[model samples]
Target: MEYDVVVLGAGPTGENVADRTRAAGLSTAVVEGELVGGECSYWACMPSKALLRPVIAGSDARRVPGLRQAVGGPLGTEAVLAHRDEMTSHWKDDGQVSWLDGIGARLYRGQGRLHGPRRVVVEGPEGEHHVLTARHAVAVCTGSRAALPDLPGLNGARAWTSREATSAHAAPRRLVVVGGGVVGTEMATAWQGLGSQVTLLVRGQGLLPRMEPFVGEHIAKSLTEAGATVRTGVGVAAVNRPDPGGPVTVVLDGGELIEADELLFATGRAPRTDDIGLDTVGLQPGSWLSVDDSCRVDGHDWLYGVGDVNRRALLTHQGKYQARIAGAAIVARARHCPLLETDRWGAHAATADHDAVPQVVFTDPEAAAVGLSLAQARAAGHRVRAVDKDLAAIAGASLFVDDYRGRARMVVDLDRQIVLGVTFVGPGVSELLHSATIAVAGEVPIDRLWHAVPSYPTISEVWLRLLEGYRDGADGGDGTDDGADGGDGTDGDTDGTDGRGGRGQGG
Candidate 1:
């Protein structure tokens, strides 16, 4: 089979690439080894969020005066699991396949690898071989997989990765989660609400070490208050499960043994490029494919790497953003267009991956942030200031839920007077992240942001509070002005790459 574009992996990243190419009249073929919709659909984003929604909803209700008494009961775990199954189409890909068919792109159900430059060989399900040649480009969107630690007995211990953690039939009586990133923290929150006694172990000083320090502190306090033991500065030594269907024993680095019905290793993610024939192209196997700002492979003009494999930003949305840019770049090159919109925030540039990547962790009190954190902005050598607000102090927050507990922060570029970053942690802060994302991405001036007034009484009022604090020079914690400490500001990161650490499972 010969096509204008050949795409490996049919995840959201791959799907979007094919979508853009097909729309531009380019014949595109997509290959997949698993479900068509990929990790975000079946395991990571969709099913995981389905399990967390009810848990968060119930938590939100309990905080309300009249609703508190009504929701004071155990959650219906069966219904939640059933709903999760439905959300993932019971682990089927018929709907996604149909959508792909409608887009006029051909789908190959098999493992695909690069046979040579611009050449792909797919091994079909029945061991049949199909050779596909790409005339324009070959895009790699294979994404990533869970990276388990090198520990004893882990292979036979039946330990859970993000896949098993999201698709489990029922919550275990006791669950021990290692790694305090998004996957571990969110799963701990979900299972704890679903009647599991959860013990979360973090090797770092606290959970979500990539974000602001307070984010981990606040989430740790909330998780502990909700009946889960949140331990920090801990590492797993080994795991043991002697019986086929029995409890697993986790040995800590400090020689402490803890037993749990199931153990989850949400360590990190490894790029899925191991067996994709990288060696055929003179690149090392099991290595991340580096790409330029346009998602094109660094050395090969005709090769592109989109999504998690590029290691730009591991979040699903950021991957899709890169997909759109890659698709546009491919189309432009194919048309012999001399001028590709390669400038920052241009049509063919994925600038958001660097400065405006937004992420929302769907825990009880949702943690959301976009752009730079205070430390990040300062480290990037931006003349910046940080302002904060207590959500409970906002009038809208009190009306939204009695005794509302949350915090908000805004980091501003002092010289430019534009918002550098924003962080919100509260019951429904996830919905408020996009507004902050726009501010950071657009580089909206603080004076102009003040004109974009927030509504009278909503969680969004936190925006107004943030702006007021910035204007009044109120640091929210200390009344002192926290300014830059001798930054050269010469080596600005030109590539649109967010320096945030990658914690995949599609984030």
Candidate 2:
């Protein structure tokens, strides 16, 4: 098959790229090895979030009518499974395929490997192989897969990565999560809420270590209260599972053995670019293809890389942003103009990404934040100012519940009077994050932010308190600091998570 653009993965990013190219009057072909919607749709984000959605909405398999006996609370197992199946279309690949065809993009159902720059070989289902050539460009958007850690006795055991956990019809009774990051926390909370006894083991001292201490503290407390035993600053020294349904006993470094029905390693992910002909395409770092600022691959200007394969921020939204930039950049290059870079807008230019990428941990009393933390700003050579507030003091807190327990903080550049960081933890506080995200992204001056009034008798009103408190000092002055702001978050942006740039993001 010949086309102007051949997108190598039909995930959201690839779909977005192909759509953008088609809209620009380019003939696009999207090749897929498996499900067209890729990992995010079938396994990662969609199914995982769907599995946890009902629990957050106060719906669970143990809570439905006539199915109450199967669970301690009230859910119809059949109905819950029905909902999941409906959400995933029973693992059907048709929705994505139809969406591709609807957009006028030809779809190939086979594994495609790069044969050369702007060239690929497709191993088809019927055992036929075809060489597909693209006239303009080829975008790599293969995404990533669950990473397995090298642990003693962990091999050949009945284990579940995110894929199995998200799609499993029945929950494991005793689940041991091997990582203490966001994925582990969410899965632990979800399964525990659905009646699984969860034990989370972390190599760090706290949960959500990437955020402010206040945020991490609250999440840890919530997770602990939710009945998930969180063991921090510890790791697995050994693990043994004799057979399926047998106990998974994990021995800690200090000689403690923790047993569970199943072990889920939410350690991280490995980009799925292996054996896909990256070596034939010249050089880059790691196993990922190195791309320029405009998402153009190293040697071949027409070839591009997006999503996890580029080794940028490994988040779904970040992947989408890359796709948008690459698509736009391609058009710009065709017009004989310079392509946009990461921080400047033009073709495929997404500059704010390095400075601002926001996400939220959806546990109860959620934790959310954006931008550089205090230490990060300081390390980056910016004068840093950090202020914190507890939810109990603010007027909004008293209104939400008499005893709402949570905290918030904002980091400031003393010289610039612009926000450097923001962190919020409390019920409903997640929605208020955009103001902070905008502040950090826009570098909005403190004076202008003061006019952005938060509604009254709500958590967001704490913004007023924060700005008022900044006074003379919280923005980085001597003693004019104000710290009276606190709330459950009456802010209007949807719920969110963070870093001192790389420091915050690495956690």
Candidate 3:
């Protein structure tokens, strides 16, 4: 079978790619070995958030004065899991498949591998082989999987990765989570709230090392306060499980041993390119595919890499963003039209992946940030200022959560007077991140931001406080001008754990 586009992996990224290509009247085919909706829908984003919402809601309820009494009991774990299962369509992809069919994209059910340039060979579940050829472009969107550490006794041990952590039938009595990234912290929060005694072991100095130093501090404090053991500067050396489904014994680097009913290695992500037959196309089978800004593979005009497989911004939303760009580029090239708007913030270019990528880590006190951090701006040689405001000072925050503990930081480019990045680490702050993303990506001027007033008495009021602080500090005009805005644009987008983005992508 030949198509204008053949997409490997039917995740959100692949679906969007096929959707766009087919909308452009290009024949598109999508192949998947797992559920059609991919990781975000089945495991990472959707189900995980489903598990987290109740926890967050309960926590929020407890913070409010009158509502606290009603929610003073443990979360119904059975109901929570059931709700999550429902949100994921009970792991069935029928709806997703139907949506694909509606979009006029062919769905090939199998394990697909690149047979050669612009060619994909899929081995169906029953070992049937089907060769698919792409007339215009072959897109690789296999996404990523948990990267387990090479530890002894791990193979036999029934360890939980993100998938198992989110989909388990019941919460374990004790959960040990390794890695301090988004998955580790979020899952730790979810299970701990659902009545599990969570022990979060981090090899680094603190949680969320990629964000501001205070972010890790705040999350660690809250996690500890919530009856979870937050231990930092600890490394896992080995795993010992005598029998499957038995207890897991994790050995630390200094010979310390910890026992848990379940162990989750939220260590990191590895590209799902290993078995995709990349070697057949002269590329390393296990390596990440490099792509240009349009998500097209390097040195291959007919090849495109979208989503986590390309190692570009790894967040699902970012992957979808890349897919749109890739699709547009594909359509433009195939139709012999001028590839206009390939520039930054253009319809055909994914400029947001560079700095305006937004992420929300759904812990009790959500952590969200976009654009650059103070350290990132300094390293990038931008003359910037970091202005911080205590969210407790905002009246809306106090009304939202009694004794609200959160901080907001705004990083501004001094020379240009434009906001480089913004971060809000507190309860209900996730809703405030998109404004920051717009400010950074649009390069909105600080003086202009002062006029874009936040609604009165909302968590968004923190924006006003930050702007006032920035203005007050600037007014002082002391001889020492540390007045550079505080905020850091992460080197990699999506908190470095969820999504991966490379420098370039092509369609």
What is the alpha-carbon lDDT of model 3 when measured against the actual structure?
A: 0.84
Stretches > 4 Å off in candidate 1: 474-507
Tens-digit lDDT string for candidate 2 (189-208): 77877778888888877677
Model 3: per-residue Cα lDDT over 364-388, one tens digit each: 8999988877887788888777887
Worst 10 residues of 1 by lDDT: 492-501
Which prediction has the highest lDDT against the true structure? 1
Evaluate model 2: give its lDDT: 0.71
RMSD of each: 4.8, 6.6, 3.9
lDDT of each: 0.84, 0.71, 0.84
TM-score of 2: 0.87
Worst 10 residues of 2 by lDDT: 498-507
Residue 374 displacement (Å), model 1 = 0.8
